[model samples]
Target: MSSVPKALKYSKTHEWVREEDDTVIIGITDHAQTMLGDLVYVELPELEFSFEMGQECAVIESVKAAADIYCPISGEVVEINELLLDNPQLINEDPYGKGWLLRLRPFENDFKELLTAEQYTKLVASEAH
Candidate 1:
């Protein structure tokens, strides 16, 4: 079973978002890291870059495969996790914590489009079955 933090909002694509004032902290969900299998490299978008909702913003390469990281909402990138450059496996170790990817200032409060923990768990379960 994958770890799902109650405080975060999740996208179907497996990105998690934590709202902090006007900025949202983003990262791949535990389920995502498990599926990717041992992260090796992470390609992050430049700060100040703007992306539409569902736009591919980054790429995470693991021993099993490479996965695209999508923006959960339209936003401008504010910050990125530089530590991941040295330890990509932090995503596998603590996805919800030290593995966070970037921060974004959203265009709107459309976070409701994201899945809840219960919904995400069902989605993952269905995928497994």
Candidate 2:
């Protein structure tokens, strides 16, 4: 099973969202990284670029495949993890922490509509079937 932090919200596409002050941090969930295999590259969205909820805004490439990472909420990107440019393995090693992909200033508080950890866990289980 993947590590699903109870505090963060999740999306059907497997991105996790963490709210901090007025910004929201986004990253791929542990299950997503596991399925993709060892990460070799990360393509993050441009700073200040706005994306609607569910729009593909980034990409993560693993030895097995390249996956599109969707924005969990409509927002403008404010920050990105520069560390991933040099070492995408951080995503395979610690997906929730130093591997975080982007930080966004949300246009609205629609984050409340995202899935809870338990719901996401169930969704992952269903996908395995």
Model 1 vs truth, CA RMSD: 0.7
lDDT of 2 by residue, 1-129 (tens): 679999999999999999999999999999999999999998987899999999999999998899999899999999999999999999999999999999999999997779999999999999999
Residue 110 CA displacement from its true place in model 2, Å: 0.7
Candidate 1 displacement at residue 76 in angstroms: 0.2
What is the C-alpha lDDT profile of model 1 across 1-129, one tens digit per residue?
A: 888888889999999999998899999999999888999999999999999999999999998898999999889999999999999999999999999999999999999899988898889999998
Clashes of 2: 0
Considering summed lDDT, which 10 consecutive residues are worst modelled in model 1? 1-10
| Prediction 2 TM-score vs. true | 0.98
> How high is each candidate's TM-score?
0.97, 0.98
Taking all chains together, the TM-score of candidate 1 against the true structure is 0.97
